[model samples]
Target chain A: MTPIKGLVLAAHGSRLKASNEEVTEFTQVLASSLIDQYKHIVPAFLELAKPSIEDSIDAAVAAGCTDITVVPYFLAAGRHVREDVPEIIEERQKAHPHVTIQATPHLGVSEALKQAVIHLL
Target chain B: MTPIKGLVLAAHGSRLKASNEEVTEFTQVLASSLIDQYKHIVPAFLELAKPSIEDSIDAAVAAGCTDITVVPYFLAAGRHVREDVPEIIEERQKAHPHVTIQATPHLGVSEALKQAVIHLL
Candidate 1:
């Protein structure tokens, strides 16, 4: 059983171009750091921007990933994280039933982020 | 001059009660750690919830803070951060002309958070 075949860094894309670009910029940083561990690391948007979650999932599968983990770059487990993202993934699953998709908790609850924010202050 | 007289860990409150609560929960963690440095640390909402930016600003002034900092707990500097939040702070400034109200960049682009996400991956 291979572990963490692919990783998707999903964000709630913004309407403002600058705001959305920041997510893409941060994703590049993450993609670089994660290159050693993950074969396919992609940045995707939930809405209001390019590369919606479904497209990201398709890319992962196209890159020969059978099992993928989608980590929402959101602050909390909102409906988008809890419901919307999963629904998108589910639809993708219909096309690639062999693939295994997992969703991680949003970045909001990550203790690492909590500690980081504290350190930032 | 008082250094960081007060702090507001501001969030884009969600329609989902659970999602909005997570911001409050994170704010408590931030408040607990920041209490030593800041006399007042408040959790405020940008919209869709209670104790908005204006109310939080009022509270900070009421707490005897002359120079206050509002830190947006958002992933990026969207229209809300670039326009809406500044407008709110401007209104508050008008109400409390003597108080020094400042708005920090949103939580996005923080090297600390970038490091945290890298470690998390």
Candidate 2:
């Protein structure tokens, strides 16, 4: 039987305790909604927050997942999305060449996201 | 003559100097393009970073703007949007009842933002 893969939501972590907690909570809520096929949903950070992208990917690999999708929880396609995230993913892919690594797009202004924002407005 | 109004881009300020700088840079770019009617464009923060939202609004009021729009540079419609920001705006409005205060939506997944994200992908 083929093992089920997982999703890793990467966020630009914050040093503020409340801010980090907020991101983690959102990721947890998002992950809980998806079950059955995609079982594991992990949240990783770029800086300040714990469990960096490297750590989360390593954890996912350890949990017997052969394929992973990385979603960047960023608002813009700036330096982090343009440079930092890809570099980290590339480095990790080298280590686990067999695992299929897919880096999803950042959470920019999408329709769903726009609705969420509009609701806020 | 109707006095000029300003727009304030308020962000959840980061301690990471680079992150703050990036936000400020983006606001500057955005402000520069709107040079005709709206003159002053200021970037304020919730915490960590300097020039808090209160300070920015105060500055705008001081600078002779009779109206101001406060744009929340946040992703979700969380507590800050539902509660804190409104409270701050109310306090400021009381102080400057003559100034029209408008709080814009957060930058969620809009078509433009999505395009920006896809570009990163």
Candidate 3:
């Protein structure tokens, strides 16, 4: 089997189901585009939603992904990004020390997104 | 005086000053690029921080802006985006009906952001 890599789009979940769905919907689009790079594009939330970060990471490992990158779908590196996420990743690392779990930077100070918003405005 | 158009980056405020500062940093970069389009770029919050959405909008109007666009810096169109933001905008509209107040879409389901993440990965 080909060594698979998972790309987890981590988000701060909300009580509203629609809010959680947004991350899934976004992951679908991102997965389609990133099919070549990452085999699994999972959307995980911090709280108030399903597919908790731990569960998503487990699923990624179960799916045979040797490398997993948890990309925070956050606009800034706040408490959730700085603290909560690292705690979860640390626990997961102990569980699956073999898997190379990586967490990417939050969505702050981006020229591309800034331009996109400018064009959007 | 050149008529200013304020681009308010409406975000969910955090108790942590660093979290709120992230939006300010992002806005500074965004503002530099958008200086030609918008006269001022303000950062507003829904709760738990200074510069409430109302205050930011009021500043925009006071600064001689005829048009103001309140862009939600949210990743999802959840309760805050769907209900809280609209309610605030409606009230602001009543106060300054002359100022063309517009709310742009949230940051979910974005192709540009998706591609940016993919490239970053």
Best by TM-score: 3
lDDT of all predictions, in order shown?
0.82, 0.74, 0.87
Predicted candidate 3 versus true structure: per-residue lDDT over B1-114, tens digit per residue: 555688899999887899899889889988888889898789999999989999999999998898899998888888999999999999999999888898998777777777
Least well predicted 10-residue stretch by lDDT in candidate 2 chain B: B112-121
lDDT (Cα) of model 1: 0.82
Q: For model 3, report DockQ.
A: 0.68
Q: Which runs in model 2 stand beyond 4 Å of their true positions?
A: A1-71, A75-97, A100-121
Query: How many backbone overlaps does candidate 3 show?
Result: 0
* Superior candidate under DockQ, 1 versus 3: 3
Off by over 4 Å in 1: A1-4, A119-121, B1-4, B118-121
Model 1 C-alpha lDDT per residue in residues B6-100, reported as the tens digit of each score: 98878888889999888888878877767888898888898888889899999999989988888877888888889888999889999999989
| Residue pairs in collision within model 2 | A109-B109, A109-B110, A110-B109, A110-B110
In angstroms, the error of model 2 at B44 is: 0.4
Candidate 3 TM-score versus the reference? 0.94
Docking class of 2: incorrect
Q: Considering DockQ, which of the candidate structures 2 and 3 is the better prediction for this target?
A: 3
Instruction: Score every model by TM-score.
Output: 0.92, 0.62, 0.94
Which number leads on DockQ?
3
lDDT of 1 by residue, A7-99 (tens): 888888889999988988887777777777778887889889988888998999999888888887888777898899889878888888988
Clashes of each: 0, 4, 0
